[model samples]
Target: MMRRKSWQKNLKIAVAALLIIYAVEHILTMNVYLRKPMLFSPLFRVYNQSGSEPHCPSVRLSTRVLPQIALASYPGSGNTWVRHLLQQMTGIATGSIYNDEQLRHNGFPGESLSNGSVVAVKTHNHYAGKDYARAILLIRNPYESMLSLFKLANSNHTGEPSVDRYGKQWGTFTEERIRGYIPLFASWIKLQDVLPIFYDALKQNLTRELVRIKAFLGQSGIKGDVRCALRDSEGHFHRKETGITLEFFYSKKQRMAVNSVIDQMQKMFKDRFENIREDMDTWKL
Candidate 1:
């Protein structure tokens, strides 16, 4: 009888605590659903209510008073993750030119980076735009980056494949693909002011990178919680389980293929690729 009474008390406490949390969520997003109807789900709702979302908040953060900044990278290089991190940090919308229709589901609409006087333009093109002041180049491990791209491409239902699905499987890479990657990898050098962000370094130590990034962007004093930033960057990903990377997902043959490609890249790019491979500590995941 005493145990039963204790159980009832715990249940009541749990119910009260849940109610309090729900009330808070509702208040934050109650009327917001109409304005930003995408602000449904009381659980993950956050809004500035007055402003539009951005396509690439970090890239377009105008270092100058005029013109836009380009956020350039090859697809699957964690550019989307960077966009999400920026959103959580600044409550600004981070969007993609290609995926605007889908970005809205995550609170970043098609016009997230539009309608603003100053914008951050994001592109996968290997070239720079004439109108931009400068660019921020984001990089990632080729094997994992290719895997991410493979999964993304295979998932696209549009029959045409998304982001140019490179090969038949996760681990199997190509000479042609590697050749394409070399140019994209090398393209960062063209920008007058390029801020190179490596994915492996970022996932391992985001707070440190973010500090560096904010300072590079001339907004070093921007106030935000490190815990929250980490949570947003780590959790906001649709494929956060870490199973899809080269470490586990790729087969022996696939790994061999990746190694050959890496060797080729290392021979060609030298320290640019090798240094990152050495720093490729993925323990944070």
Candidate 2:
């Protein structure tokens, strides 16, 4: 009888402890839900409360059929930031060809193959065998873009790199990255339905550029709250300016080499922007 009583008491204590934990968790979840309704919202479906402006628009998969459009850019050319802006403006999640775990966990739930469900798929590769019906080519100055990539690589894709991190390896890295631009731009330039968006232009006028993008995507029907999107324009992955200077990435010799490549890229764009008469096979990748 004594052992039975002890066993019953322990079982009761364990049951009570579980109940307490459940209650605490429920309370906490409720608190979060009340404070930020967007936090608990689902990613694959739109959620809009009646007669109230949403705190943050819920990102959803495309409800209507859409073309497979790519948001193409070199790494560190503000691709993630542009996706954030578009997500806010459209309430549709963007996709990516490469699945980035960090991006999937963060805002981009659609981090897979470029498909109709996503508004636009992000990509860095524009070589042969990589083709899309339409593309938004995001261009940033080579120097800043390459430096940004270096920082991202060093800091695990979210932070700036330390000055001490710069060394001999960076020089080689810089050369390789700068060379990559030629083929990337060349491939995209051949596309008939491509929108070339400069990074600086977007910074200067976001709303105007968004309007252009919306028209191009044939999404003028959906009324996106531009003001709300603009409220937090700088998205999660944007690395702010830091004290670490990036001048050491290139020496005078390296600068000349980089500039020569830049000149060739400009010549290609200028010569073939309207007419892609030049044979693509001849261009060295």
Candidate 3:
């Protein structure tokens, strides 16, 4: 009996060792493949529908025209509003604004096709370690953004449990579960902690910002008035107000915490506050 027990312990140790080796090998292989540039080709191909040609119009537009204009925002900081504005300005709407599944699959509809012009893609993901020629980062007060996100995620029949699906699967949109996902939603959330990082980096340099934006837009040889574009886009969301107060679903303490988060965020992105100021200054109503 003593001999049998000893043999069983040895077998378990060997099995554990084999499992560890298998896991390490699998991880190494994945790391190697992920590090390869060719891996993104399939992803780009699916977006462009052009097989293996980097110079295809769609591919060229993606790489050159826009360079990279990731409309980075929390879950609902008016991304749809921005996307619609961009679409109207570009004169290409494949009717994708209303389709969530399509947006999830194709990234964004307006820019996915070979329009041969600058494309504006909306994403909830973080910057993927690529140098973007121009990027428009739209941020909202975190409390408002988070609350809006939670509400949106919970509303749809198709939506999964927020903590379980996004939290566990991708580890995003919350602090506790950001590690497993790419771009880690938690990092974005922590943007509230150091709002100054974003403001100082992006806002203080407006001329440089405009130059980068123009450079990206010029890649498609497209030129138009951005002010006019903003007007056209803003008109779409115009609705008659019924004087209804939008109530917060969170308790007073929760609301206060969210407000605090927004206050910190505002300080960080204070430079861009002028854009909002300019809008308010010109407000006719």
**Best by lDDT, which number?**
2
The candidate scoring highest on TM-score is 2
TM-score of each: 0.58, 0.71, 0.44
User: Candidate 1 regions off by >4 Å?
Assistant: 1-67, 110-119, 156-176, 219-228, 240-285
**What is candidate 1's local distance difference test score?**
0.55
The best-first sequence of candidates by TM-score reads: 2, 1, 3
Window of ten residues with lowest summed lDDT in model 3: 276-285
**Candidate 1: deviation at residue 99, Å?**
3.6
Query: How good is model 1 by TM-score?
Result: 0.58
By summed lDDT, which 10 consecutive residues of candidate 1 come out lowest? 34-43
Distance (Å) between predicted and true CA of 94, model 1?
2.7
RMSD of 1: 10.3
Query: Candidate 2 lDDT, tens digit per residue, 1-285?
Result: 999999999999999999999997898677646542122222223334574555666888888766778899999899999898878877888999988899999988888857888888899997454547788888777777888888888886677667677887688788788778788988887887788776866775665566667777764244465545665666788777776444545788777766777668668766756643233222222
Give the per-residue Cα lDDT of candidate 1 at 234. Answer: 46
In TM-score terms, candidate 3 sits at: 0.44
Which pairs clash inside model 3? 195-268
The full ranking of all candidates by lDDT, starting with the best, is 2, 1, 3
